[model samples]
Target: MKDFLAELIEIPGGSGYEEQAAELIAKEFSRLCDQVHTDSFYNVYGIKRGSVSLESGERPKVMLAAHMDEIALMVKDIDEKGFLRFTSIGGVDQRILLAQEVTVHGREKLYGIVSTVPPHLQDAGEAQKVIKMKDMCIDVGLPPDRVKKLVRVGDLITFRSPLATMQGSMVNGKSIDDRASVVMLAEVMRELDRLQYAAEVYCVATVQEEVGTRGAVISTYKVQPDIGIAIDVTHGETPDAPKEDTYAMDKGIAICKGPNMHPGLTEKLIETAREYGIEYQISVAPGPTGTDARSMQISRSGVPTILLELPLRYMHTTVETLNLDHIKSGARLLALFIASLKEGWQEWLKY
Candidate 1:
């Protein structure tokens, strides 16, 4: 799990440019799924057939979607001095952009560093404020002519941060927000290989979620499954974060409850967790969550949906942190729930 996640996080799959990550996930799923394919939009679908067919002469379709795209930068322009100006591709916090190493995916992969005015040259009161992203430039250590020759306008730029193992089972790296959940999909598939499930599972690695959940919108429509479980990341507890808003790391998966999530499915998930002694925390969302669940719920005639969140710190940054054990536990919970979906299980989705 650790090595797989490490390799996944290192791959650059920013929003609207998820082909590389999609290729890797499709390859991995090919071994686990009965049919694995990438759609036109780069959403990787891995289907596992079920043992039991329903009275309707069809097995229930369960869609498990996790976004593969991460927050990234796009080169909006290049100045005369080989400096690259950029705009955020997703929800990027400008405060973290200073002096970060990045990879410019232009004509060729070029290494660069996000650079700005040094403190020594800063005007009075300049050091007290965060540097705006527009003021920062990616210096590729090349002259103007070479930079223009290599990098063009509208090229993608991804953080070059590598995954680092922390004390115990904790690991921190880039793109852990949804990529970690992607790993959770793998774990669930692995566990299901040993269990007998009745629902045909669609493990979808969705694209362009960070931008606006566009991938979820299209993929859910395509799958049109009976149930949709959107796995994502939530705010993890930090020293200065509010206890009401953040969950503790290393505790368990956070199962969300609210209007966006189906009540019956949420109850079943909780009950399954209790029955299996799987540790889990409850999160209350009064309205729509900022996850694929929201989009999934409104797709087609409206599929019964739920959201499972892995606690993560420093979201939208390169060093998003999470507990690997939580992923394992979440996978077990999901697999057990899927296994419980026997004949006439559609009744469980009713309000």
Candidate 2:
């Protein structure tokens, strides 16, 4: 999972530019699925046709969706001094903007950094102040003419946070928000290909979720599965963050609930975790979750959806941390869930 995540972070896929990431995911799913296809919106859906005959008239096809896009910045302008000014394409904490090394997408890799004023040059009243986007600029050490030729006004920029080994079970890198979720599905697809489960499994890798969960609308309209499960990353509150409201790493997957989640589906997930003795946590959302489940649920009438999140620290930042054990545990739990459905599926949903 550590190596898998690093490759995804290296790929420059922010919102509208998901082609590269989509290609890699599609190729992986194609190896496991009976049939793989992509919609006009670039949502990759890997289908495994039901191997068992359905007596429920129309068996609810299970659709597992994970967004492939991550939050990043877009180049707004270039100054005469060869510095690049950019703005956020998705949510970002301006507090952590200074001195961030980033990669600019172009024919070649262009390296730059978000600059901060020198301490000696700081004003007395402004010494302890937060800088806004307008005050920030990315310094790409290049001549003005050369920088103009490579970087344009509309290029994308992502944090150049490389994945590295941490503690025995931990992995730290950028974009762990949902990349781990996507990787989990990749492993699950391989298991599904081997198991040949009873339900029609749709492994969908969605795009543009960082912006507004756009791809799910198109993908769900096409697949229209009975049950939709969106796998994503959740805030793992640490010492600096409120523990009562957040989850922690190495505790396994956090199964979330609330208005966006299907009541019956949420119950089933917790029950499955307990029955198998898999480490799990309960998360609650009071409103529309910032996940693909929200989009999947409201698409084409309605669909029962549940959100499963992996605890990650420092979300949408330069470096996001996650536990590999949690990733494997999540994959195993979801795989067992699909297998358990064979004996009698809808009976569990009835309550």
Candidate 3:
């Protein structure tokens, strides 16, 4: 898991540029499925056929989606000091911006650090102010002319934090927010390969989710599955965060209930988790979930969807964290839930 995640996190896939990770996931999925197809939008769809085909009695079609994009910085302007000023690709916290090291994508990778005025320069009272984007500048160890030669507008910048082990079971890294979700889908693929299922499964590694969930919106319309499951990260609050609003890290996965999710599917997911002896928690989101499920639920024909969340703390920041055991449980729970989708899932939904 760490090896696969290392390759994914090392790739510079900010919002719109998820092609590299998408291709890697597609290659793995194609090896396991009967037919693999990629749409015009570049959402990769791989299918594992059911025991009952279209010729036989109908079977529900299920689609499982995970996004490939990770939050990052895009080079907007490079100043004389060789510092890169940029905008964020997704929702990010300004609090974590100070003194963080980053990798700038060029023909050759350049290492830099987000820096600010030294403490010696700032008045002691003024130092209490929180760091903002404008106050931060990247310092690549190069002279102005050489920096200009290597870096340019639209170059990628990513947080340079490595996968960190917290406590015994908890892990922290750069893109665990969604790579954990991708890993969940990978586990599902492996499970289905090991066991027989009665429903057609279309598993996708969706692109552009951090930006607008454009990938799931486009791909779900194409696959038009009877049921959709969107996997992504949610809140895992630490001592500094709001306790009532978040779950504990390394405890369990979260089952979402909200307007964006189908309640019946959520109930079924909870049941499956319990039956499989996988620990899980309940999460409630009143409106748009900020997840791929929101995009898919409103797709053509209005597909029913549910969201399975891997609780991650400090999301969109340099040190996003989660538990590997929770992720593994999420994968098992999803596979068990999908495999239990009865032949009449579509018919059952008609009421």
Candidate maximizing TM-score: 1
Q: Pick the candidate with the highest lDDT.
A: 1
Encode model 1's per-residue lDDT on 119-235: one tens digit a residue: 789899998998788888899999999999999999999998789989888889999989999989999999999898878999999999999999999999999999999999999
Better of 2 and 3 by TM-score: 2
In candidate 3 the C-alpha lDDT for residue 326 amounts to: 83
Q: Model 1, clash count?
A: 0
User: Which lDDT values do the candidates have, in the order given?
Assistant: 0.93, 0.84, 0.81
Off by over 4 Å in 2: 193-196, 347-351
lDDT of 3: 0.81
Model 3 TM-score, 2 decimals? 0.93
- lDDT-best of 1 and 2: 1
Clashes of 2: 0
Residue 283 miss distance in model 2 (angstroms)? 0.3
Give me the displacement of residue 83 in model 3, in angstroms: 2.3
TM-score of each: 0.98, 0.94, 0.93
Over 1-351, each residue of candidate 3 has an lDDT whose tens digit, in order, gives 656776776676777777777788778777778888877666778788766444446788899998888888888899987878887888777778778888888667999988877888988787788878865788889998888999998988888877877887777878877988887777887777666577888888888888889888888988899898899999897888887779877668888888888877777788888887889888889998888999889898798899989888888877788888886778778878877866556644542
What TM-score would candidate 1 get against the native? Answer: 0.98
